[model samples]
Target: MALTLALAVNELGTNSVKYGALSNDVGTVEITWSLRPGAEGRGRELVWTWVERGGPPVSPPSRRGFGRFLIERVLAADFEGTVKLEYASAGLVCALVAPAPEDRAS
Candidate 1:
C-alpha cells in the first residue's frame, strides 16, 4: 500500500511539475486525506484528495497516461478504492476513496 501510494503521488507530482500547478511560480498543490468510518468504525475508508490551485486552467488530458492508469486502476485495485479526476477550468482535483487495508480483510 505504501509503495502504491508513493507511485500514485509521484505520478501526480510529476504531472504537476510538467503541466499542472508546479509548472508556474504562482501555483500550489494541496493534498489531504481522511478516514471515513463505517459501522462500528471497524470498516473505515481512506479518502485522499489532491487539489491544484493558482495554475493554468485545467482540461482533461488528451490521452490517459500511465499516471492516470496507475491512480485509476492500480491504486484503486490495491486499496479497493475509486479515483475521480476533475478537470475544472480552474484547476485539477483528484479524489481517491478506498477501504483501509485492515478493514478490508474483515
Candidate 2:
C-alpha cells in the first residue's frame, strides 16, 4: 500500500510541478484521507482526496496523457478503486475511493 500510494503521489506531484499548483511558488496542494463505511455499512473503504489551490485557473486537458491514464486507470485497477479528476477554475481536484486494507477495517 505504501508503494502504491507513493507511485500515485509521484505521478500527481509531477503533474502539479509541470502544470498544476506547484507550477507557481504561491500555489499549494492539500491531501486528505479517511476510513469510511462501504456499501450498506459493510466493509470499510478509504476516501483520499487531493485538492489544488491558489494556482492559475484550471481547464481540462484536450486529450488524455499517459500520466493521467495511469492515475485514472492503473491506480483504480490497482486498488479496485474509483478515481475522479475534476478541473475546476480554482484548481484540480482528485478523489480516490478504495477498499481499505484489512488491517484498517473495524
Candidate 3:
C-alpha cells in the first residue's frame, strides 16, 4: 500500500511538472485523501488530482504508460478499486477507489 500510494503521488507530481495546470508556478496541484462511510468500509478510496490555472485542458493518456500501468495494477491488485481520470477546466482529476485491507481480508 505504501508503495502504491508513493507511485501515485510520484506520477501525479511528474504530470504536474510536465503538462499540469500548475505549469510555470502559475497554478497549483491539490491532493487529498478521505475514507468514505458504508460500502463495507471499502470506501478508503484515494483521489489525487492536479489542479492549475493555465493549461490546454488535458485528458488521460490513451495508451497506458509504464508508471500508470504499474499504478493501475497495484490499485486493482491491492485495493480492488478502479482508477479513473477526469479532465477539468481548472486541471485534471484522477481518482482511484478500492476496498480497504480489512475489508479485503474478510
lDDT of all predictions: 0.87, 0.87, 0.65
Candidate 2 lands at a TM-score of 0.89
Give me the runs in candidate 3 sitting further than 4 Å from their true place: 40-54
Candidate 2 lDDT, 1-106, residue by residue in tens:
6776678899889988899899999999999999988977668988999999988899999999888898898888777889999999999999999888773432
Candidate of highest TM-score: 1
TM-score for each candidate, following the candidate numbering: 0.90, 0.89, 0.73
Tell me the TM-score of model 1.
Answer: 0.90
Which tens-of-lDDT digit does each residue in 36-65 have in candidate 1?
885566688888999999888888989988
Pairs in steric clash, model 2: none
Model 2 scores what on Cα lDDT?
Answer: 0.87
List clashing residue pairs in candidate 1: none
Error of 1 at 14 (Å): 0.8
State the RMSD for candidate 1: 2.0
- Alpha-carbon RMSD of each model: 2.0, 2.5, 3.0
Q: List clash counts for every candidate, in order.
A: 0, 0, 1
